[model samples]
Target: MSSLRLVPGTPDAVLSALTAVLDGRGTPFAPVPADPAAAARVRQAAAPDEPLEHDCAVVLTTSGSSGEPKGVLLSRDALIASATATHDRLGGPGQWLLPMKPYFVGGLQILTRSVVAGLAPVVAGDSFTEAARRLTGPRRYTAMVPTQLARYLDTDLDALRSFDAIIIGGAATPAPLKARSAEAGVTAIPAYGMTETGSGCVYAGEPLDGTSVALDDGRILIKGTTLFSGYRLRPELTAEVLRDGWFRTQDRGEFMDGRLRVIGRVDDVVISGGVNVTLPTVQARLLEHPRVKDAVVLGVPDTEWGTRVVAFVIGDPGRDELRDHVAETLPRTWAPRAVIRLDALPMLASGKIDRQRLLEELR
Candidate 1:
């Protein structure tokens, strides 16, 4: 049986312990924040008293945006497969700039890839720009979510262009953001995948080596050696997703020019006035508007409409004007019924919009 070790969630500790695990020199580890409440939850989920499956090499906690924490079980073989495939797809591994925390799969993969390439990753300093300037490599790569990418574009275009490639994932990439990234001399590759698939198996709408993507009723299904073993102690949930080695992702996707294009989460759709509205579709339109900087489209409870479309915007834009912008291309019902202006949207540690927090705001 494998043993479990709990450590502080700080990047340094997490990376040191992760290196030991990946090198097969120590027990599987789980990261817990220093906060009492968060640490308690992580401790309970880690189940220190229970022995893990022999093949399990790491126990990663999910963001748990919807509910309780879940520990994802990933094996060393799977991690090696992912590292190999990533290097093969990227033309070879050189050096990686680590800008994200190691608790998540993406950050963990960065560390793992560096180890596989026999090079140490350059952890970003206090500022992303400063850390980027410190990097030295013939081929350097890094990953960022949409929010971080936007911040870099606005604040440090030089830092963004310093890397050979920057991968964006964790949420949908707006069309405007992609275009802006390209215009700024950034080789930004929009990736698609999740923790269960062991990070991004698809880069820039193409599957990496050893990764296969298929569409099931518009939902994305992934088959690859990088897939996780299962959810810790959640056999039923694992059974629901992993069927015959193909993991059923909850995100909807489509094929354009023989490349996979992720639409949005399956549950992101809402019925407003008895008409279905895809939040991504509405959000893409909102992003096209010049006045709107960043926006999130969500559904709120409504009596007249099954669910009312609401938009939270970062910039100063009139509700009517943004609504009309969306209506110009989409159906009138798809336009946001209400808009809330915020100085900045609540973000998770991984730089994703905290959708559950936004729902609580409505409540």
Candidate 2:
């Protein structure tokens, strides 16, 4: 049996090691996270066993926003398929920008796609916006989560528009952000997928070629050539998610005009006074307020209402005004009972909002 390889280094070194594995020259690698605890969690979960699949090429660590980190096993064929389909969907292979860390699947895909295209991806150092300004290419592309994109909206419109395509994932891209990108003539694509489905099998609410998407009672189920084999060292967790060739996502989705629309996570719903409140819908309404830059709605324990809908907002909107805003769009009970003001939401290294951390803050 081949030994499991652990790689630790800067972004460039990580990309280089990932490329070597993709090129069938190096040992299967598990990219290390910057956080010591996260890195150790990945290493613990990535320990090799006799039942491990021989074809595994990469072991990716999930962001663990919802739970414990699990190493996702990606075979060579799956990685290739994901890269091929992404290029095919985006017109063709081109130069890429590495604005995020290479440990996550999104950043790793940038390296893999660049290797397949025989192009060197531009690595951002210290200042991503500055690096983006210096890049010169005919067909340039990059992938970033909403947090990174949010930081560049006003000052980097020109830099953003320079790219042929900007792939946005890791979290839900707000409607306002999408509008701003469209108005600026930036070809921004919102992707929906997790570490389990390679990088992203669905772009802009549409499944890519060679990928199948369906809604099973509001939960999103995806099956594709790019799907990971399974979770490393967690057969029970893998069995719970992957069944009958379909990966059951925690997110809820809907179909409209033959396109998929992500509704939110199944765990995002909470009962308030015997009525189900969807956090995403409430958060969307909160974002509609001009003063509110970003918002995360969650259910906090309340003895009176079972679970009261509470919102963490990043703007200066008044409690009454924000409550009235939600009440206008949704039922009164759905409005957040309380609003907690934050300068900025805590973010994971992957640029996703740290929901678990926010819950801890409440406790």
Candidate 3:
């Protein structure tokens, strides 16, 4: 038996040990005692009976921006299934590099796939130059958020080309970014899904192999082996999201050309002047503008309408020009009634746009 250190009752310690054991590194954990006498006693006696047998595994905590964060259990089998589907879709698991942190599900998935594919993942330390150095060889695969991809596109087109495929997720990929990245031979695949679904189930607007998607009253629903068992210690919440073996994703989506296109959150849609406006769809169109770097659309209260469309933008462009641009693309009524410029958009710890904070700022 391989001797390994384990700290008794702490969740992080137990989780770390589980990751190590599942990675096939060692067994018969020897946990280092904590300084506190009471905690030390608990650690000395605490040992998980469940044996870790999968490839590499980690528990992901939900962002909990709307409520409390809940841990989702994931096994090696589920992770491998996700990776296998991705590899099958993308051809093969090439050399992997990650600019994202390893703690989140997206970051952890990259490492898990690297371990499963028997390739060491190159991790960037505080700089893209270090990550670019690791991409020196032939074709490589990496996962990045849209913001990171945009920065790379603005600065390092050559480094971006080194990637065989760049999986863009964690938020909607602006149309301009998608078009630019594809033109540069980056093979960017815009993905959609969450921690409960083991990262991404939809790639480039299509559901992955072994994944099924449906819309219940406009709410996106996913059914697959990759779905997590349930939220830890939140049976009521679990029951709310899961139904009939399908996970009812809070995102609202529509089917077009046999592909699922996520519009926005069901609750994010608002009625303005008796017309329903989907913020994400409007934001997508706003992002298509050449001068716009990032954009977010939200609903603000109004007496004339139940809610009025408001847009917050990061790029420096004339409000009239943006309004005209939206008029040309979307319905004039759907165009934002008010436009505000923001220096930067708030982001959650998971690298997703903080919708709650945006709403708060709007209020």
Prediction RMSDs, each to the true structure: 1.5, 1.6, 6.3
Worst 10 residues of 3 by lDDT: 47-56
In order of listing, the candidates' clash counts read 0, 0, 4
- In the range 1-363, model 3's lDDT, one tens digit per residue, is 222234442324544554565576634342332446433332333223434222224445565655555556565567778888888888877667877755467876776667667666677666665676776434478888888888888777887786778898888787787888878787789999888888988998898898899988998999987787665445688789988989998788889998888887878878999998877778888888888888888888899888989888998887788888988978888888888888999986568878688877765
Listed in order, each prediction's TM-score against the native is 0.96, 0.96, 0.82
Give the residue spans of candidate 3 off by over 4 A.
1-57, 65-67, 135-139, 302-304
CA shift of 194, model 2, Å: 0.8
Candidate 1 lDDT, tens digit per residue, 203-273? 98999888999999999999989999888777899899999989998889999999999898899899989
Report the error of model 1 at residue 213, Å: 0.7
Arranged by lDDT, best first: 2, 1, 3
Candidate 2 vs. true structure, TM-score: 0.96
Off by over 4 Å in 2: 48-51, 133-137
lDDT of 2 by residue, 1-363 (tens): 566777873577777787888888877878877688887877787874434654688888888888877889999889999989999999999888998888889998988898888888889877767888766655789999988887877767778878899999999999998987888788999999888999988999889889999888899999989999888877788899989999999999999888898889998999999999999999999999999999999888899999989899999998999999989979988999989898889998888888888887777
